[model samples]
Target: MAGLWRKAPSPCIGICKRPGGICVGCGMTKADKKTFKRRRSKGERKALFRILIERLDGMGRLARWEHVYRRRCDRKDRPCPLDKL
Candidate 1:
């Protein structure tokens, strides 16, 4: 059963440059990524996503990130966690 459990998809979107304190792609810091990796529960990940979504929207990059994040989910055939938010 453990092998059948699939972890949630990351919100990185492959753009990993953090010029400031935040990721230009996912609106998360390096610390955020590390925290995300450590969080195993869907509730924790989804809660983080909500915080990042608001930040991204404030930065005017939410649309692009959402587009890429959705595509990433599609490629993996996994449900977009954002959808549940």
Candidate 2:
């Protein structure tokens, strides 16, 4: 059972963030501060990269839509004062 677990693929992509931050995309938890420390096979890494790209693309689209909504609201003279709350 231990060998089966060991053979299971890792979730690390080579594109790691600085200071061991959790990946915003694949959500891979870093075991250490060193970048690319997780020993994932090439195939695993490629899959992780694809997931990361999809996550980023989704986030980008959401952000653009949010910006457009905010701009539209502003143009209509809607007073979005934080202090009003």
Candidate 3:
């Protein structure tokens, strides 16, 4: 049970701009963000993260997000997947 409560990495970049109900930084919709925060399954969270990454990439904002993501991760002292981006 304790093992099921592991922390999940977020896709936030601190540049939250919800234009058209979608965030420009992480490419998640307002509803998606809400669900993401409450999600408890590691696999589900990871899948969401991957989808966000793909969305960012498709929008041509992947590089910019990567830069901000590194800073965000550093501030939180968390590991980022910048290399994977």
RMSD of each: 3.1, 17.8, 3.5
Instruction: For model 2, state the Cα shift of residue 45 in Å.
Output: 0.6
Which of the numbered candidates is closest to the native, going by highest lDDT?
A: 1
Q: In model 2, where is the ten-residue run with the lowest total lDDT?
A: 1-10
Tell me how far candidate 1 lies from the true structure as C-alpha RMSD in angstroms. Answer: 3.1
lDDT of 2 by residue, 1-85 (tens): 3232224323332345533455542344454223333534545444544554455455454344334434544665553221121
Q: Which ranges of candidate 2 are over 4 A from the true structure?
A: 1-36, 61-85
Model 1 poorest ten-residue lDDT run: 1-10
The predicted structure with the larger lDDT, 2 or 3, is 3
Please report how far candidate 1 places residue 40 from its true position, in Å.
Answer: 1.2
Q: Relative to the true structure, how large is the alpha-carbon lDDT of every model?
A: 0.80, 0.40, 0.71
List where candidate 3 sits over 4 angstroms from the true fold.
1-9, 81-85
* Tens-place lDDT digits, model 3, residues 1-85: 3222234356776678987877898899878877876777656666677788899998899889878777877786766544433
Give candidate 2's root-mean-square deviation (CA, Å).
17.8
Which ranking of candidates, highest lDDT first? 1, 3, 2
Q: Cα deviation of 59 in candidate 3 (Å)? A: 0.5
Give the candidates in order of TM-score, highest first.
1, 3, 2
Looking at model 2, residue 27 earns an lDDT score of 43
Clashes of 3: 0
